[model samples]
Target chain A: MNVEQHHSTWVIILSFFISFILAIMPLPDWALSWRPDWVALVLIYWCIALPQRVGIATGWFVGIILDVLNDTLLGQHALAFSLIGYISVKIYRKMRLFPRWQQAIVVFALIASAKLLGVLIHSLFGSPEMNQPLFYPALTSLLLWPWLFIILRDMRRTYRVS
Target chain B: MISKEERKLVLRLIVFLFASIALMLTDHNSDYLKTVRAQLLGGVYPIQYLVNWPVKAGQSLSKNLNSHFQLLGENANLRDDNLRLQVKLQKFEDIKNENQRLRRLLGASEKLGERVEVAEVLAVNINQSRRKILINKGLSDGVFTHQPVIDAQGVIGQVIEVGIFSSIVMLITDPEHELPVQVVRTGLRTVAKGMGTVNRLSLLYLSNTELNTSIKVGDLIVTSGAGQKFPKGYLVATVIQVNPDIGKPYAQGQAQPRSALERNWEVLLVWQLEPSTVINDEFKTINSQ
Candidate 1:
């Protein structure tokens, strides 16, 4: 297989930039707990779409940026995103063959597990018992996956980004 | 079966995970990561500004399109408020001078006022669990960490992170915060802790003896100035509930914060007069007396 090395790296970087914005955007109090994990969703899409170019390292760095952005414990999101990136990369081929709805379920599991990892570490650090909204973002992310996939797919094709 | 690349991937993940946990541990247990966070905050400043652009645009647009009648009413209200404030300012001048003279006579430090700067809240709900807000003022504006924040009503929070153009204020309602507050009526000094929610603070370790007797519902709480963490006598909260412990040493009570913690837009950052300057003022007042 001939690999196309001419990836529009800026387009990929731009998508991640927008994801970072959404992650930090201010939300109303009612919606605060339900704000979807934008960075995680975008990273997962890139890992699966261009597994060769984006993977564990991309996810890890993005997580660090998010930790700084949200002022959370350092490396909390890093560890979670890295694991999800690895999983997505490993299953990218098989995931592409699955139906869209089936794909959403797997995405939910990936993001939810990552969020669970975050909750665990925070609990270790003595954060209060905030378990109810633990899966809200994951649920929101699951609902968003279908639309996001199409939007990002169009972006990828339009810019011919790997 | 794991292939060669897969093994490499697994090894990389393990190494990264180990490194991050180490980072988290260090950050949790010490202040070493603060410098790193401060440095990275400059890079993030632009991103935050970009996200706030639409909100700022909307505000300016509304201001520009205000109806003539609405503007006339707003101007009248402002003029009315200005006249009332001017009358109060004249009396305030006399009281400040009298207070300074009394403080000099008592040999206490003059602590009447602190210089303050007003900042707009740029963002809120930075994290769901931690109660924090980002303000438009930051390191460039000489904002230091741990500086107290307040509004027209009362205490809001303190600066936790200072970036190039923005700073994060941790509200008193955050689970990690503990404010030393004094009961206005009984002079009972106790620690008011965050209940992990807005408008509510838990006064911890209140003696059972004072419960239901001196510390009751509707009592006012203010900063005790303990540990010099916060300025003295600022309104903090008001007791909303007092549940006494019959046999225990302490009673559990709740207070509502005087400030609108969750709805703040414009906040004041206090510039506490340093002890050295305060001492100098004490000497100057003494010499004059």
Candidate 2:
């Protein structure tokens, strides 16, 4: 498959927007409590898939929007997202060589790190504390990574768009 | 060969970090972020409405189906109950009229004012840490900032942001929330603060010695109006657990919120009442001292 470089940017943006919509979608009460951070998951996937064009800067911008959208402390999600994006980009070449299952485990660790960083940043702002539910979404995101990767990978291949 | 764009990228990251620092400082120093929030939410609400439509419709369909069965069974039951209630209501109407006459004779203040508009909850913050919910009404529906929200059960929260078609409500269960309440049986006033856990709140700064006061496991707690921000007598919670230690200055207790705050699909926003402009002659005489 010939990968056209320019179209990959649009693919990334479109996927990110869909992730934002998913993140905001209302879920059933029990399900919502465990809903993954779809934006972060999508962003990380794109960073890994097309490392040359999408990087920390893109992640940071989306982070700011998510922070505003969720109304949390400024820079909480942005900083975490950018840092995670940077890490993924740094190892993208090696990651592309790994098996799908291995990549999913690595993505889980990255998402988990971002979640912890978010808590650390918010705590610096003196917001009231919460229990483990705040961290559960990250793990949930990791568990969804393999499926998301498979679906998105096929879309990129089929559309000839990517 | 590495391009100049690669070098520029490092500079851009530094710039973004610096910008974020400035934003953090500005958001901390003033209410400037509130305007940004309002504008962003206004723009995104249409998208939010689209995303929520399917879920809202599904919920409503299920609710309608469930109620339809009950409606048939309840039709005859409600008719009989309605007749009995009509008779009882006549007695209440007479008492209410007589009470109004006595209150006017004693120059008492009227408590219930104009009715309020009710709104339905459309969505909740996907991020659990923020603890915010969105309602279907916005500024067009007369919802303004800090308008108190209540359900049929009790106080829920207050409107914090208004969009064109929707408003964001900061729930009382949110970690940042604190409401002043009093024990109805003991008249002991204290501030109830959210623990960010469901169905629980802890009374802060109450003295241990006061634990002996008539406050009990089932004592009703209502807004004290001591802070005077919220109206008085709105149900807050019921004391569920109280523990006192001999040496501690305060007793620890928990409350089950009167409202099923986490599950309710609809809430009402209480509009603020204007204070009486007429000064009492008795108050004028006392102020001279």
lDDT of each: 0.87, 0.76
- What lDDT would candidate 2 get against the real structure? 0.76
Q: Using TM-score as the measure, which candidate wins? A: 1
For each candidate, the DockQ is 0.69, 0.45
How do the residues A54-87 of candidate 2 rate in per-residue lDDT, one tens digit apiece?
Answer: 7888888888878766767666677777777777
* Candidate 1 lDDT by residue in tens digits, B202-281: 99989888885679899999999986868998999989999888888889899999999988779999988864676688
lDDT of 2 by residue, B179-259 (tens): 999998878888888877777889887777777775779999998876555787789999998888668778888888999
What DockQ results for candidate 1? 0.69
Summarize candidate 1's per-residue lDDT along A1-162 as a digit string, tens digits. Answer: 233444578788889999988988877778877888899989989998999889888888988888988898889989999899889999999999998888889999999999888878978998775545778899999999999999999999997776
For candidate 2, give the lDDT of residue A151. 86
In model 1, state the lDDT of residue B108.
79
